[model samples]
Target chain A: MFDLPDAAALPRLRPASSRPSLGLIGHGAFGAFIHPHLARFFDVVVHDPADSASASLASVAARQIVVLAVPLAQMRGVAVAIAPHLRPGALVVDVCSLKVAPLAILAEALPEHVEILGTHPLFGPQSGKAGIAGLRIALCPLRGRRARLAAQLLRRGFGLEVVQSTAEEHDRQMAYVQGLTHIVSRIVLAMDVPPLELRTTTFEHLTRMVDTVRHDSEALFRTIARDNPYAAEVRERFAAATAEVMERLGAP
Target chain B: MFDLPDAAALPRLRPASSRPSLGLIGHGAFGAFIHPHLARFFDVVVHDPADSASASLASVAARQIVVLAVPLAQMRGVAVAIAPHLRPGALVVDVCSLKVAPLAILAEALPEHVEILGTHPLFGPQSGKAGIAGLRIALCPLRGRRARLAAQLLRRGFGLEVVQSTAEEHDRQMAYVQGLTHIVSRIVLAMDVPPLELRTTTFEHLTRMVDTVRHDSEALFRTIARDNPYAAEVRERFAAATAEVMERLGAP
Candidate 1:
């Protein structure tokens, strides 16, 4: 169970420094993808328990902001372990795909003295071949006056489109949009037809999607599909649609 | 009730000249799109059934090639009506989305003396904006030596990739690739979300698809989705998948 902060009681932590020191909890593809851009705004410290120790991230821990870019399933444990080492009053936020689950986890794990916020970058690292010029970011405020400020930094400094929504609403919509789209793409890829056989514009479109999620970690897929309570419902709906269509085609 | 040539007995046709006179049987968006390009290959003639008569099509019937760029449902009827007027041994072809049905229609409707073939340009008029450089054209051979020649013109003259396949197989696969993709895209468009609310990368992808088909005529959509026998099966499978996902989401 998590102790969520009241909307009215959140803290406001804004520093006067030109560049904030930032600690990142995951160094996976998503972490590596956003780190360089984020480094322009904040001094970045990256920590991945699966890859590195707390001592490794200590050098960057002195920064003003801490960012958790870990898998949704591991977010809680990493937040708890890193909570003690974070600098006092450092604004902590996450870039997880699902908001509600991680928001709950971070709220429960972090100390009351620390500020917490959650964010979801709408575009995958693989999506931006050019750069993050027109990408969107969803910011879910948990317990901080710094939440809006942190979101503004992402928007103004980095040119990200920021949308504010509750963690629950974000998860509910994501279940339909992200989860179902990925599942459909996965099913298409699993069919394993040769590229030459796929000539239709529609097949080409589906191929783009399959390519998008092909590099994602299995853990990431599992977390998004299973950890989010709304995902199962979305997946089930897609499966039912597939089944009915197959039945009409006399397909098993 | 439609008479068609034996699939196994269909003969290929050869191109008549380096610059053949071309007759276009429809004057709608697709016909207009192809008209300018046809001018490069033949002395072009344009006819629209709603506006032009058989006598007008016959005025240009002296051309070596006649391209039926009309709607799929009207393709057979037009072919039969225009057959008696075409020059002997002239090559007649169609640009319909469905091959099997139209192939049969042309084979039965055209005079035995005139060469007939069915061609599906695996692209739209919008593709003309880039020129036909790397696009694909599917050739479904029906009668005469015109089929082989048509393939050559599509390749050597316009620089399109030519794919040869039976009309039945083409329609079967297109049901899944084209029909299902269009159906899903329409569903997304029908969701009626305001443009301001749709900011996600996934939604952007879906919107691109919706935009592609939005300008297409309802007859084209119906022909691709309903008239093509294989489409029902493919759409059924896709609809089933969507339903399955929706059911999981507990959508009523």
Candidate 2:
């Protein structure tokens, strides 16, 4: 259902040798998970400060497409570092959990001649462990025409369901989506309830959600819980709702 | 996986005409849901004050096997009303959400000659709509050996997974399983968030869990959140954990 137009229905494709070079920053868990999928269509080069085998930042930034896979906290620094080396008309994409701030940073730091696409792939290494086919990716065409092509490519190449949204709209919805999910998961995990043998279907679904986000990095949690502009309000509302429920139940 | 020994391996079974009479009280949502399932193997008779078509209380209570599917608050009253009519050696079962208090009430109100089986079928009309195969039902043999036979029948006949435990153990585990799920779902529902266009896999799981319990009666919610002896502690722990998480995130 997520398939786009047949690969042959599009403009003529370049040969493998002439395929566009793509650079990826941050060889983190998500970066590693996505690297292979991106490699199927591009001559991919990766640069991560912590990886000894990574390509130099300058060479990686000069590619036709550059994807920033860094943490939200580090996005600005990476964007600034790559700005000087990014070739004109390069399509710069960011795979951040929150869209508004990261996209803003990319827009501010990148050269005006470059294109920007903001994406948040809804699945992660844990959720996408089997395969990413039919998974969702939210695409924000922050700047220029390349973002539309990127959305089409995401759909056609990877069989992803792309939801086209603006950075503001994406982050607004994510305040409830990612923000509420992560907070609830963290609370349940912290409650430290032992493994229960009497599992209900609802409880199993709740725990599955908890387990999927259990291994996520603390940085991602902070990004979703704090970095998103609307997340704090959502968190506060949830906490208030929880308190009201406890009060109604007369739980002291 | 929930199957018991083959039905043919059991002691010779009675023909359909000779099937033991089963009486069910409190034809509420759950009572109606389970009525057909019980009718499959027994000559089932149902009694409910609200259901005008139901059988008379005295006649229903005098059956060879009697089941009470009532709210936790009304359990004692139902047991008291049925006490004088229970036949000797009659197998009486109460399907309440919490096992401890209801089992205690049944033990106190019912005559010593009548057997008592406390069961918490971990599903209802909403979750069981698709079919109850492999669904779980907690069985507490409070006062009889007949509980084992009932468990076997539940497995072999209805494809139910029976977890046999004492009343205390059942309530304790359900404090986490049912208690946590209901409370979280209530909080999310009360938050009154609009339908989101951007949904993650985890969020989808969360919402699905919420939807399963959305139609549950307020009485069931109270039974899970207030009737269970251990539920308050779990709710308190969840509240405390939510506070800690919000504080850590610097969320007001």
Candidate 3:
């Protein structure tokens, strides 16, 4: 049932039984997209309540590594649900767009015995439809030393560019990057501009940018526009700058 | 002093003496960038008041084909200046971002005996730096049948995609295409976003779009935003859409 055509070609140097056990807690778009890649290096057990193929939450959370790929709105509830079942020294990783809030929630909800790692893969099904190699992932070490090992594994094994950053720093930069992009995309999509035969290179670039973010979920857009603390300031700056541009253009 | 490395390799089946004489006004950025390409098919004589290397205005305007590449604000004055010198059978071509106003001015100022054609090469020095073979150029036949010959020559000789459209229809499409792009670029540039380490594919696309129009002249920006009749409506729609997005996100 898996759509991975490149699964057979993956290097199977180690046996499945000898690999570490990875517990995945969601079967949404991102969770499903990352399953096969994680399966190559770990024996994975999924625990999505909505999916019939998932294992029990207790059994999945007892693995050596637990990955929370649920939506940002559900991060706190899921973290609390898995806290009691996590084993000592287990690493808890989160793949969320905004790091500060989710990482804070994980730190307050999960047990101190378990290590916490905050990661933003920076790509999804649309961008990684072919393969995820050469893509970027931000690693934020929230509560332990395991983030370095995770960084090394992602860099060497998956051919990813790992950028080590703190939750605050990541959120600050994303305020402009993700925040501005989603805002512009949403506004342009709302404009509903008609298709035209005459287009310039700059207009094509704007169209491609809008197309990339058009398929993102409303929850994701909300997380990017509202969840990040610095996002409001960036949006304000953008609005003011837009007003200045309109004034300069003598817009009626 | 031209930066064109592909000049020598251009097809030269016909001798220079047999080619039609082309008078080019305004040795500005676009005029200079397009000079070599026109030089391949015609004997070019440039007339720029600011450039010492330019020929006299009378001498340049007397050629078989007179090309007006001046700024939109200066278009009426230049058209009036050349009206006395234009030959009866000569063809006049204008390369401007917005077609309707410039074409109207040319029709009003120039003699009816000379033909008029309006063209907008969608790429500039930055976008066409490598080569302009596959680039697009919008051709609006304003006054006469000479536009068809110009289209065939651009399509066959330079491998350009010539889109035949009327001046009004071209301006309507461009009000969204060029107008929105330049407006968004100006606003983003005014925002002064800092250098970000963590960037998504969509953010990169936005940055590249801004970069493409970042170096564009303010005159061009003004022409795209002010010269087109429908531009004000687009800006109003974009502003209203931005307000809706902000309201949906509960922007404080």
Largest lDDT belongs to which candidate? 3
lDDT of 1 by residue, B89-208 (tens): 787778899998888888877778777788887777653466768877788888876566567667766778889988888887777667756665554444443234415565555555
Candidate 2 residues lying further than 4 Å off, grouped into runs, are A1-6, A9-15, B1-6, B9-16
**Cα shift from native, residue B186, model 3 (Å):** 0.9
Q: Top model by TM-score, which number? A: 2
The residue-by-residue lDDT of candidate 1 on A149-171, one tens digit each, is: 66666666667888888888888
lDDT of 3: 0.87
Least lDDT summed over 10 consecutive residues: which range in candidate 1 chain B? B1-10
Give me the TM-scores for chain A across all models, comma-separated.
Answer: 0.86, 0.93, 0.92
Q: Which segments of candidate 1 are over 4 A away from where they belong?
A: A1-20, A39-43, A52-63, A145-180, A190-194, A197-203, A217-252, B1-20, B52-63, B125-133, B146-149, B156-159, B190-198, B217-219, B225-252
Clash numbers, per candidate: 38, 0, 0
TM-score of each candidate structure, all chains considered together: 0.75, 0.94, 0.93
- Residue A80 lDDT in model 3? 90
Worst 10 residues of 2 chain B by lDDT: B1-10
Q: After superposition, how far is residue A249 of candidate 3 from its true place, in Å?
A: 1.6
**Model 3 agreement with the true structure over A1-252: per-residue lDDT tens digits:** 111113233465767766788999998989999999998778899999898767999999999999999999999899999999999989899999999999989989999898888999988887788899998999999987666667777887788999989899999999999998899989999999988899988888899889888898999999998889998889899989998988888853
